[model samples]
Target: MPEKVNGIVADAIRRVRTSSGVPLAFAGVVTGPTTLRLQHFVGQHVGALSGLSVDVGHGLGGKVVALNRLLAVDDYLRTPQITHRYNTLIEREGLRAVMAAPVIVDRSPVAVIYGAMHTPTPIGGRMLDALASEARAVEQEIVAARARMEHAAEGENEMRDRMTAAFARLRDLAGTVDDARIAEELEAITRVLIAGEEPAEEPTVELTGREQDVLSLAALGYPNARIAETLGITVHTVKGYMKDAMRKLGASSRLEAVVTARRSGLLP
Candidate 1:
């Protein structure tokens, strides 16, 4: 599990370096409850920082993970805020400025992404924002990967594929309807097809028929562009529906929204 997470974080670190134009960037995935092992580095002059074990509340990455927030220092070696646990490694790599962004999943920190400069410079808002955005992207990927893993582990891939196809066909049929009432009824029945049995307790949240349509496709692991194409809507409109569905489901990510809807008997 840690290795899979490290792979995802490593790819994300490379992207961060490219997008943020940072001189140095590294990432680590959680190896244990209180520890994260540094696994991947990009733009580093030396390998001193590689494979370093970081503990919660110990250093920049640790603090970011502990607090579940982004943190940066102009001069990491001379900073009083974070512990100098990796001062020698930082010095070996000639790192001065550093920022750490927590990759959180389901409200828990799963990884940390670090960006650094070789000289003493403040980690600006733009760089911090870019790193944070990448972290969120990583979080989404991790969640979706986990969902795939769980689905495979449960040996339901075959059933899932059939359900996904059936749902898509039903949605296509629903689209052909001229009457609003008939279309809505079709959507309601599609929801039943998604969730095998009606939930005993009703969910407090309510999503419009269109919101459910978008979210149902999302549940099948369809990306927004594909969902838009299939539903004959603009990508921007697809995003709007997804955003509204996530808000209504109290979810922070697309996978989370899908999971919540399934649990709420809104999707299968």
Candidate 2:
């Protein structure tokens, strides 16, 4: 289990215990391929379960983990639905009844949270529902955390691909240019681009309504003449708008201006 998940489960245990009025609430995380170790707990007077390892299908928790469902035994020591391997520990702690809820993530059981009573009181439906609700909350937290991590990883991969393409384009331009000074300048820009340094501060640039309309058409591969005809403007006026837009965007070419505008949310 992830360290973040461990903290989440721990907080879930505390929440469940407080909300349900359960005397003892504890949790075991799947620390191995087939075993869950008792990790976090509350209201424990005995240390018999301090380092207990519950294997799949071996105990009540194991059964819950293996079945991927909630399990409760009113008389835990005598329950036939599960094996009694941990009865000694339960007896040591003087627990008469217990319930286990599995925290599943991505269709796999990642942790098991348990609630118990020191007396021979059966866990009621309402209390069981509360425990299951906490487990569901933990499952949602895990799923959301995983989604954020995956989204960040995808963003990083996209940025790397873009940087690689930019570097390749700069290299190609450097090789094709005849002017030595221009080639050296392109080489220097390539080094800066590859270094991935943060720009000082971005200018807060906005495009006018007319400028946006022209750029949107230009992005669709419209020539200046076609844009002028579509917008009921002269070709010279279209060129003037594009030139001003490109200057504000700090783009040397029409394509770069369009890309910058879209990236900066200046154009759709």
Assess every candidate by TM-score.
0.57, 0.65
Candidate with top TM-score is 2
Residue clash pairs of candidate 2: none
Worst 10 residues of 1 by lDDT: 157-166
Candidate 1 is scored at a TM of 0.57
Displacement of the residue 142 alpha carbon in candidate 2, Å: 1.7
What are the runs in model 2 whose C-alpha is more than 4 Å off?
Answer: 45-47, 193-268
In candidate 1 the C-alpha lDDT for residue 122 amounts to 75
lDDT per residue (tens digit) for residues 83-182 in model 2: 9999999899888888999999878999999898887777899889999999999999988888898999999757755654555456556767999999
The global C-alpha lDDT for each of the candidates, from Candidate 1 onward, is 0.86, 0.82
